[model samples]
Target: MNHSRAILTLAWREILRFLRQRNRVIGAVGQPVLFWLLFGAGLESTFRLGESGQSFRDYYFPGSFMLILLFTAIFTSISIIEDRKEGFLQSVLVSPVPRWGIVLGKVLGGTTLALLQGLLFLSFLFFTEMRPGLFEIGQLIFLAGIAAFGMTSLGFVLAWRLDSTQGFHAIMNLLLMPMWLLSGAFFPIPSLENGSFLLHWIMRCNPMSYAVSGVRQQMDGSFLTADLAADYWFPSLSLCWAVTILFSLLMFSWAWKTSSRRVQGDLR
Candidate 1:
C-alpha cells in the first residue's frame, strides 16, 4: 500500500472506531463541560484578576478547552491498548507499513479528533464576550492542533508499553491530570508567587503551561486579556509557541522511538 494511503486508512479507521463508540463521545465531551460548569460556577465568586475584572470562569475558559482536547486524546490513545488486546495491532505489526507510519497514523487520528473537538468548544467563545477575528481564532485552533499532537503522542508512548487500559488510566491520573492543574489552568501563576518555589518553577517549566498561556494570550482581548493591570506571570507568546511546538516534537520523538522496540509490544 502507498505509505500516505496506509497512514490515512489507519487514521480513518481510528475516526470511525471512535464515532461508533457513543459512550466515548459522551464521556470525552461531557466530562469537560461538566468540569467547566461546576468549577467555573463554584470559583467565579472567589477568583478575580486584578483590574482586568476577569472571573475564574473566563480565566479558565481556555483551560477547559484544553481539557476537552486532553480527554479526547486520552480516549483515542486507548485504542492502542484495545488494538493490542484484540490482536489487531499484531497483524499491523507484521505488515509492510513503516513503524513511523503506524505512529503517525495513530497520533494523527487522535490529533484530528482532539483538534475538531477543541475547535467545537472554541465556538463556545461565541457565548462569551471574546471578540477575536477569524485569523486569531484560526491561530488558536492551530495551536490547539499542536498541543493535541503532543498530548496524543504522550499517550501513545504510555499506551505502547502497556496492555491494560486500567494501567494507562492510573498513570494518566497520576501524570496528566496534575499536568493540567499545574499548567496554570486551574489558577493563575501569579497566585503561586508566595507559595512553593518548587511548584512555581514546576508550572513555569511545564509545556502545558505555555500552551494554556498561549490560548489566554490569543483570547486576551476579552477573556483573560493580558492588560498591563494584571501581573505579568505568563511566558511571552513567542516562548509559549516555541515550547508548544517543541513539546509536540519531543513527545512524538519519544513515541516513535518506543514504537521501534519489541518488548511489551503487544498483549500476546
Candidate 2:
C-alpha cells in the first residue's frame, strides 16, 4: 500500500458509499430537524431560559444542530460493523496498510459526512428567529467539526468491537442517548447558586454539555448584544471550547489505539 494513497482511497470509498445511499442523508438530517420542530412546538410555552429570555425553539436549535452532527456521525461510523461482517475489514487488516491509515480514513470520512449534514442544518437557520451571521456561522462550523470528529471516533471505537448492527444500536442507545439528554441538550440545568446539585454536576462532567453550551452561547443573540458573555446559565464559552477540544483529542487517541487491536473474527 502506498500509505497516503490507501488512506485517501478508503476515505473516498466511504464518501461514495454515503452518496449512493441517499436514505442515510434523510435519516440522519431529517429525523433531527423533525424532532426539533415537534419538540419546539410542544415545549415553547413551558421552557423559558431564566435571564436569557430565549424561547424554547431558540434554546433547542443549537442542541438540535448538535444532534444533526451526532446523527450523521452515528450513521457514518456504524459502517465499520457492517464492513467487518462483509469481510472487508478482515481483508483490509490482512493488507499492508497501517492501522493508523485505516483509522484516519474512516474518521475523515465520518467527519466529512457530519460536517456536511451540519452545514445543511445551518441553512435552515434563516427560517428561525435566531440568526447567526457569516462569521458566527464559521465559528459554529469550527465547533461542529471538532464535535463531529470526537463523536465519530467514539462511535468508531464502539462499533469496532461489535458484530451486528443491532448490537451497535443497542449499545449506542444505552450510551449516547443518556449522554445527549443529561448533557443539558434537552433541558436547561439550574445554575450552581439555585442548586440542582447532582444534576448540575453530571452536566458539568459531560463533554457533550460543553459542545451544546458553546453552540448555545454563539447563537443566543451575541451578534446583536454588546456583551459577548451574556448567558451565565451554562459553562463559560472559553471553558466549553477548551473542553470540547480536549474531548476530541481524547476520543481520537482512543480510536487510533483501538484500531490496532484485534477485533473479533480477525484473520490470523
Give residue 106's error in model 2 in angstroms.
Answer: 0.3
Output the number of the lDDT-best candidate.
1
The TM-score values for the models, in the order shown, are 0.94, 0.92
Model 2's lDDT to the true fold?
0.83
lDDT of each: 0.86, 0.83
Stretches of candidate 2 off by over 4 Å are 221-232
lDDT of 2 by residue, 178-251 (tens): 88888778886656666578877887899999999888777754522322123325677889889999999899
Candidate 1 is scored at a TM of: 0.94
* True lDDT of residue 256, candidate 1: 95
Model 1's number of clashes is: 0
